[model samples]
Target chain A: MTKLMIKEREVVVPGDIIAEGMNYLPSTGTYRQGQHIMASRMGIMRLEGKVVKIIPLAGKYLPRRGDVIIGKIIDVNIMAWRVETNSAYSAMLSVKDGTSSFVRRGADLTRIYAIGDYIITKIINVTSQKLVDLTMRGPGLKKLDGGRIIKVTPTKVPRIIGKEGSMVVMIKSLTNCDIMVGQNGIVWIKGEPKDEILAVETIRKIEDESHVSGLTDKIKNFLESAKR
Target chain B: MAYKKRSDGRKFDELRPIEAKLGVIARADGSAYFKIGNTEAYAAVYGPRDLYPRFLQNPEKGVLRCSYGMMAFAGSGDRVRPGPSRRSTEISTVTQRALSPVIDLDEFPNAVVDVYIQLSQTDAGSRCAGICAASMALADAGIVMKDMVAAVAVGKIDKTMIVDLDYEEEAFEGEVADIPIAIIPSSGEYTLLQMDGRIEKEDLMKALELGKEVCKKIVKIQRETIRENFKRSEK
Candidate 1:
């Protein structure tokens, strides 16, 4: 027998009863305690067939494979550069993965990616112990120049991009600013100061309203109205 | 004279009017304020981030650290000292232990989650109030937890066992026994139980039963406030 105590998309906090009985399986942000399935974190519930999972709305970034992220260089060494990936785990960008071309064994790593510089990179690997490795050998992977950075809830990154990059692309076109959003929640915006502010404001709006439907039209209307 | 009437005129099963607010500290990963009657506590949660002093790092999972202190003017008696005392240290250790069971930190290797609790005012049951606030802050910080914790002070004042013991009742000139307890509501597990003074076995059991019911009420407030926090941020 299966009985669900909550609705399909209800917001739940830790220990909230999602369902009872053994017919449904708990997954992701949920766990099974005896016959009861409870939420283990705060998030929105998603019911897929017989599986009940919760999509977390807030948390620090956790490294994952193949996700392009923005990280700040924290240290420089002979073998690699330590990068803060906006996560609990610090990642390493080895000399081999630091650049496409290399000359010698020992070179000044700071010249490539200094401790204070920010770069767009991709996570190539993350060990079970959460040792992360980063690479700069892909397109759009490079050091970012001077720009203003803002942080958002990491879980909202997907919504900030929207379906097929429509939401972000719309903001880029509307504000006439360059913007890059990291999956880890660090956003870099570069343009006129006013344009940068507008971009930041619009992105935050998207983050706040991500759960609401008809978001694209609402954001478009907001941007248009703010411009006038 | 027998304990005829509650000095505060509250029912034996009644608790102080509680007020809770979430995310009050913007810079902390999670923060909350909890006030029960005249007692108030503020708790902030930080990390799941790197822990320093390389020697203290745990390779298997994250460590939870807690610091509890009261302001100099927060005491019902003499002023509290400005630093960690024996009593504060004891409460901090117990608070850390009380909140540890529900949190799953295995996903964060070589990391630490720090909970800092401060009491701005006190009546009695400051430790219980601190535990309640810390639990809410931990959950608000998005820490994965199996369940939520709720804490309250329950004790026997002479022949009457009350749900929440205030400062006056604690100092009553009769046989008084004060017990502060924290519980994981979903499973009815006791994570914290400490008592001062003495009680018979049957009386203690009855007081603990009242404790469980009071904890349920505290959990209800915690759950509603946590959900309300998200709803407020949605706009």
Candidate 2:
């Protein structure tokens, strides 16, 4: 028998029993102990059918494989480029994975991705040792140019993206701005100065109100009002 | 000696008035300002960011570094130094250990979480107060922890067990024993235990039990403060 110990969207702290029995499964920010499911962090409970997860209200980003992230090149070497992923662990982008072109050995990698240059990349792998491997060969992955990068809590990134990219698409259409969201909470926005500011403000509002219900509708209303 | 009430007119097992507030520092990742009777302390938490000085970085878990300091005017009579003293260093080490167990450092690798505790007023149990406030600050910063740590000092005053000792009570030359204890209320696990002055075996047990009860009450206040802050931010 599966028993839900907490309501949907209720805040819970670590060690709080969120559920009981094996009929339910635990996801991110939660852990399982025997027949009980417990919260592993302080966050709001998210019940998706039989899958229970917790969305943290605050904290730095923890990189995961296959996540599209924005990284700043911190160091360059012959074999790879060390990129700061806004996480505790820095990521590495090998020459072969970074670009399709084949270059000879001893080639200056700085020309490809110099220090302090922000790039939109994907996390190809993250080992148990926390060594992150990044790739920039995918679609929509490249160096961000002439755009302002704003950060929000990484846990709120899903809210900014909305359900199936609805929220981000809505913002882009309303402001005519080209925006890219990194799984690590870095947002790159390229548009008119006024539109850029509006987009940033709207994203921040979404981050702040992510835990509230009817947020998508609220954001839609906000964008409409701003346009007027 | 005849039994007498404390200068503050509190009972033997009574605790000092406690006030705890979270997010007091706007610039810090998480901050708390708290007062226990006349003793006031402020604590701020920063990072889980990359630990610099390369050699200090831990590969498996994040490191928590705490710095405990007393302001020059914090003491009642003589002005104390503003920087870290030998006593402050010892307190900082013990405070760090008290808080380290609760935080799930494995979630953050190669990072350092720095906690800075400043005592603005001294009333004998400031270190305990600092630990309590620093734990609140860590939770407010949204660091994942198994539980919050709460601490209190229990002492024998004129053969009476008192929960919190003020400056005068602490400095009394009478036969007394001051034992400061920090515990995770939910688990009843002691993270810190220190004793000053002599204590008999039976009296030590009594003091531990009383300290645990008082710490439980303090933990309740800590949780309430964090919850209230979260509620306010929701709006």
Candidate 3:
């Protein structure tokens, strides 16, 4: 007989037994061990049908194709610019894909995206070597200016953004801060100095309380109180 | 048996009170503090970031490096010279090997995961404590692992086999055998096995059995610390 040893959404660390017997299937952050399905990392366990997956609550960001990530420009050569995407591997934004407008050969790329500058880019390719290729031609993809960037845990990003971006919209509407949250866990905020600080604080709070149920209402209350 | 009563008054199969905490160092990617008896160890994990000295990079997967150190005043007697000593290097190598089998770093090609374990105090079993702390630190960093590793030094003093040997027991004026070992809880496999002195084969097997039992208790404490850390962060 198959048995589930852990309740759904239960927190589990590596090697924790989630289920026993062959009725269950293992998914992300989980693996099969003989007759048991075990957690392979620290995370919240979720059950979907017969599949068991552990959603990681911690760890560094891993880049994926089609993810619109915010990255810091770290290097510039004649052909491409190297962007640090808050991960172990950096991405390349070549001259041809850097901008919609034609960039002539031997052009001064520093004028476009210099080192120490932050930009929102879309991942175009991720090769087997973990090498990444990025593009800045998409709508809303460009260099960010004057706004301070803060990082949250990448895995908690969905909660910060909320369903259809309701959570971030709430923070912006209340704090009057223009905020853009990147999938890579980088958040850029620009507004009145006080509003920017409030926005950053509120986002960090969400990251911390992401595991708590009914968090949206709690955040709403938090914003309402912070306004006074 | 000349060794009738333990100097510390602990039973032969007893371990000292242990305390464990995670994310103790704010600057580190993952950090843990583990103390057993009077010996305390702090381990910090960094990187999976870029691996420098290009030649050292492993294109297939990330490299795991462990460095074990002790402060000059960490031990009794003369002030120990600071920096990497022969004994520290040997312990560091073994520590890395003990932890590598459990972690999967295939996703981080050409990167490196560095674990630094520093002991601020000592009784005995410093290396084992360091290994335990390092294991937790790696997991706290979100490194996927097959299982958590727990360690304890089990040995024989005179004719008595003991679970955890303190400094006094180590320096006991008798035929003593000190075996420091690390165990993977779920699989019940030994990742670390080193011994000093000598014991009869029968007694050695009994000592290992005792150590595995003590390690399960240590693993319970380590896992609880991680769970508690998340609970505190939720608020």
Candidate 4:
């Protein structure tokens, strides 16, 4: 399995001698000069002098078709819950999509996810207009109330999440905080009095400094120090 | 000596203490919120992407679209809806022009760049502040441009030219002609231009010169804001 490292928004053209065994191009994609180092998945790409090196693009919060994200029920209407996606365009969680269970005629659906209720759901689709669709039927995907919500740079969510579920699992184990990271940049943290505070602070620190390198190390130190 | 007073006790020639915050809106590609005393404005940048069908899109180069809006209550009194009005449209056009000269529009072809400006507070020079905020937002968005665009308003009040006017002072009982301009001080070019009332050609020339001087100061402050933001972003 051959892999190429992409750095600084550029990839090396294959067959070009790159300082004797520095790094080789990935076998999957063809490289052209001046082409943007496409983030195959979402991540941070590192490059050195036109040679690919480190890639940290692997993280969750990947917005996919029909993947549910917990959203704040911002507006209520006769139709559905207008969810603020923490982005420009809000999404709609229709009364019909709320549950397979029956909703009586003109029943106040607000009983389900009222204003400010954070519900977990999936992105049914995203229109070109930037509109988003959401659903609620999934594991651990449900309404959230009485928890503190913090907004961060949506692009940094993957970084905060770390590789696979490792980062979040570490946070959960360290702080013992029940954190649900919404793909839309909203994070809900709930736990014991002191643990919740530590978790929120650590998450906020990650948010403030997410653009830098070696964040995982910093986060690890944070969690470790908090444990002591 | 007939002297008019400002709400903040600033003299007619004086400018308010300027404060700016970039990246206020975390989600927008680039965003900034600024306050010049009581006058505050928020700007957000979106795209160098394909233009929507409803809007006019330039073929050869990217089209820059600016939307300037004032909250009804942004003035001294009364709140208003968030929508486009004639004043906002005019301001948007001038601001867009001010930015055109500095932006490397050719870098983004067959696309549209949208700048949304919302006035949270309003005194006078809202348009000028809007231009400044928009420029900062563009920089925050990481859009490539030749130089920073800075703007300020210069007006002839009581036969004397003053830089940066406030509402109460501008509305003082005298004939005042104000010109708000966006200038690339390094290149000495104007991208945004507007004049209200009338002034002698020489006074206009002088106001233009003063406007440039004021903009140079503003540009320094603007760069500092961008630098501070970069520093914090690094942290």
Give me the candidate number with maximum DockQ.
3
For candidate 1 chain A, the 10 contiguous residues with the lowest summed lDDT are A100-109
Q: State the number of backbone clashes in model 2.
A: 0
Candidate order, DockQ descending: 3, 1, 2, 4
Highest-TM-score candidate: 3
Stretches > 4 Å off in candidate 3: none
TM-score of chain B of each: 0.97, 0.96, 0.98, 0.92
DockQ of 3: 0.78
Candidates' chain A TM-scores: 0.95, 0.91, 0.98, 0.72
Q: Which stretches of candidate 4 lie over 4 Å from their true place?
A: A1-207, A210-216, A223-228, B1-13, B78-82, B233-235
Which 10 consecutive positions of candidate 3 chain B have the poorest summed lDDT? Answer: B76-85
Specify the poorest-scoring 10-residue window by lDDT in model 2 chain B.
B1-10
Candidate numbers, best TM-score first, in rank order: 3, 1, 2, 4
DockQ of each: 0.76, 0.49, 0.78, 0.06
RMSD for all candidates, in order, please: 1.3, 2.5, 1.1, 10.4
- How well is each residue in B188-208 modelled by candidate 2, as lDDT tens digits? 889999998988899999999
For residue A94, give model 1's deviation from the true position in Å: 0.4
Rank the candidate models, highest lDDT first: 1, 3, 2, 4
* Alpha-carbon runs more than 4 Å astray in model 1: none
Q: Write the per-residue lDDT of candidate 4 for residues A1-228, one digit (tens) a residue.
A: 223433343322212211223244322222223322222212233444444432322111224476546677889888688986654346788887777788887888888878978777878886544456777766776787666787765656777788896778888888988888876677888888798889888888887777677887888897897788
lDDT of 3 by residue, A1-228 (tens): 899999998788888999999999999999898999988898889999999998887788888999999999999988899999998889999988998777888889998889999999999999777899999988999899998999888889999999999999989999998888899899999999999988888998898889999988999999899898
For each candidate, how many residue pairs have backbone atoms clashing (under 3 Å)?
0, 0, 0, 14
